[model samples]
Target: MKFRSSLCLRRTAAALAALSIAGSAFAFADDDARRAILDLRETVKAIQADLSVSKNAQMQLMTEINRLKEQNRHLTGQVEELYNALEMEKRSTRDLFGSLDSRVEAFEPQTVVINGESVTVDPKEKQAFDEAVLHLQDRQYKQAENGFKRFAAEWPKSPYRPDALFWWGTAAFALEHYKTVISTQNQLLREYPKNPRAADAMLLVGSAQAASGNLKAARATFQKVQKTYPDSEAAVTAKARLASLGK
Candidate 1:
């Protein structure tokens, strides 16, 4: 009975030691779980911080992009404005040059055909010559005579001289300026014998002499016209005048 009591006490002491070891192990496991939880919480906090920094950077980048887009739009508008201004300047320059060229042309010489020949004449000179011819066409006899006289005096070497002289003689004849007609027509015949108006001029001189009662001189003049221009209209008129003088 004493051995049985001793064995039972020994088993009770061993059970107490095992229970103490199990308590110590459980305490160590709880400390490990707490450390693991703290590490996981720190990792999550670090990840959140990184995400915040990234979001801020992304927002700043978007702001910068928007600013750059606005700047580009402003630059584009300025470029378009410059292009339009350049185009307007070009057109203005072109128009100015066009007007200047036209003004310059007004003072420049122009080429014209006169009496089957090309001649270069000043604009002012052409205007004067045209005005004189217009006076003749209007049958303003005194004005025509004065205009032709001025044209002959001002442009003596002009190709239109022969026509001007002949018209002067015609105007003088219409005014019954017999001496003027005789002198003018004679001058034309002497200076431009081969002129297109030569036959007509000689016919006019012959008629003037007849009107002045110089039949002998008139007859000789008409005969000369018929001989000088046999196939001309002046020659036909001269023949009729000669027949009338003979009667």
Candidate 2:
């Protein structure tokens, strides 16, 4: 009976030691699990922070790109406006130059008709002739005579020669220069016989001769005029003059 009691006591002590070791192992495992859970939570928080920072950076970059695009569009519109303004200025300049050119051309000399014939006269020539004729119209006899003489000498081949000679003779007669009248009238008759002023020139010569006290010569000229231009107005005047001269 004592041996059985001793064996039962030894078995009880062994079971109590096994129970204490199992309790220590279970405590250590629980501490390890808590540490692992804490480490996982810290790692998740770091990952979330990194993602937020990346999102912010991406948004900033997108905003910058959009701003650059808007600025580019504004600059493009400004460039186009400048180009259009330049084009309009160029067109206006061209139009102004064209108008100026046309105005300049208008002052140039051109062909015109004189005495039923087409002729090209210089601008200066026309102006000078008109001024000389204006002097005659103003009864400036001396100036008309001098101007007509100069015109005859300078423009001998001009279509105005016949008219100039006729007016020169008339001016001379007005100034009582009978010798110059006769000479000028003779020149008109000799040079431009087919001119419409030829008969008038002959009549002027006869009148100048009569004024110069050459009655015989004057009567002969009047008779010649009546013979040469039988149906002309000068012939009728010559007939009246001859009748007055008692021839």
Candidate 3:
């Protein structure tokens, strides 16, 4: 009975030792599981923090994009306004230049026809000649005479000189200044023998001599006109005058 009791004690001691070892192993396994769960929770918290930061950064980026968009819209409006202003300036400049060119053209030299001949004259020169012709056309004989005389003296090289001399003699004859008429018409015939008005000047000279009671010289001049310019109107008029004066 004492040996059986000792055997029982040894079996009980072995079972107690095995049970303690199993409990220690189970405790260590539980601690390892808890640590693993804690590590996973920390990883989850860190990911959440990173996600929050990223969300905030994304929001900031969206705000910046909107701000840049607003700035671009404002700049586009300003650019359009500047382009319109530039166009207006260009139009105004073109108009100003056009006006200036017109004024300059008015003062510039012009080509005109005088006495069936094309000639270039300054505006002032043409104006002066036109005014003298106007005086003659108005039958202001004294003024016409003076104007033509002045034109001859002032513009001796003018293409209008021959016409002016003829008109001067015409004015003098209208006023009964026969000597002046004779002298002026003689000058025109002498200077411009091939002039368009040469036959007319010769006829006028003959008329002046006849009016001053020099019929012999008048008849001679009229005969000369028929001989010199047979196809002219002055030649036809000369024939009529010769018939009136008899032979």
Candidate 4:
């Protein structure tokens, strides 16, 4: 009986050792699983960090691109404004040059048709004559007289001389200066006898004489105009004057 009891105690001890070994192996397996899970979590965290950095970099790149685009747009606007300003300046310069050229051209002599004759006249002479005629047309008789007098004095050899003298007498007659009309018309008839204005000047002389109360001298002058230029318009005026005198 003692031997059997000892053997049973030995078998119980062996069973207890086998159970402890199994428990230790299960504990080791649990520890290994936990370590593997921790490693996987670390890897996932690293990947997340890298992805965040890439996203931030992409956002910064996009912002820089947008800024550059805005800067380019602003620069383009400025360039367009400058181009428009430059074009306007160029046009203004061309206009100024054209104006200056026209002004210079006005001072040069030009061909003009006067009294059915084409003549080249000095700019100053033309300007003076035109201004005198303008005064006459405007009925500024006193100004007309002075301007014609100046023209006669300045351009003594001009083709406009005979006409100027005739108009001077007419201007004097309009002002009721009878003696001045007589003298100017007589001078025109004496100096330019062959001119087309001579008969007109003689008729004006006769009228001025009639206005000055020299009826006998006016009649004689009218008869002379009719006898000298019978085919002229002045002769017709003289005939009317003589008939009126006879009445």
**Which candidate number maximizes lDDT?**
3
Residue ranges of candidate 3 with Cα displaced over 4 Å: 1-107
The lDDT of model 4 is 0.90
Q: C-alpha displacement of 64 in model 3, angstroms? A: 34
Residue pairs in collision within model 1:
none
The TM-scores, one per candidate, come to: 0.58, 0.56, 0.59, 0.62
Per-residue C-alpha lDDT of model 4 across residues 1-247, encoded as one tens digit per residue: 9999999999999999998999999999999999999988999899999999999999999999999999999999999999999999999999999999878868887788766778887788888988989998899999988888899899988878888888888888888888878887888888889888999999999999998889999999999999999999999999999999889
Pick out the ten consecutive residues of candidate 2 with the lowest summed lDDT.
Answer: 121-130
The TM-score leader among the candidates is 4
Error of 2 at 27 (Å): 78
User: Candidate 1 on 9-55: residue-level lDDT in tens?
Assistant: 99999999999999999999999999999999999999999999999
Model 4, residue 119: what's the lDDT? 81
Query: Mind sharing the TM-score for model 2?
Result: 0.56
Better of 1 and 4 by TM-score: 4
Model 2, span 1-247: residue lDDT tens: 9999999999998899898899999999999999999999888888999989999999999999999999999999999999999999999999999899867756776587876878887665666677778888999989999989899898888777888899899999999999999999899999999888899899999999998989899999999999999889999999999888875
Ranking by TM-score: 4, 3, 1, 2
Give the winner by TM-score: 2 or 3. 3
> What clash pairs does model 3 have?
none
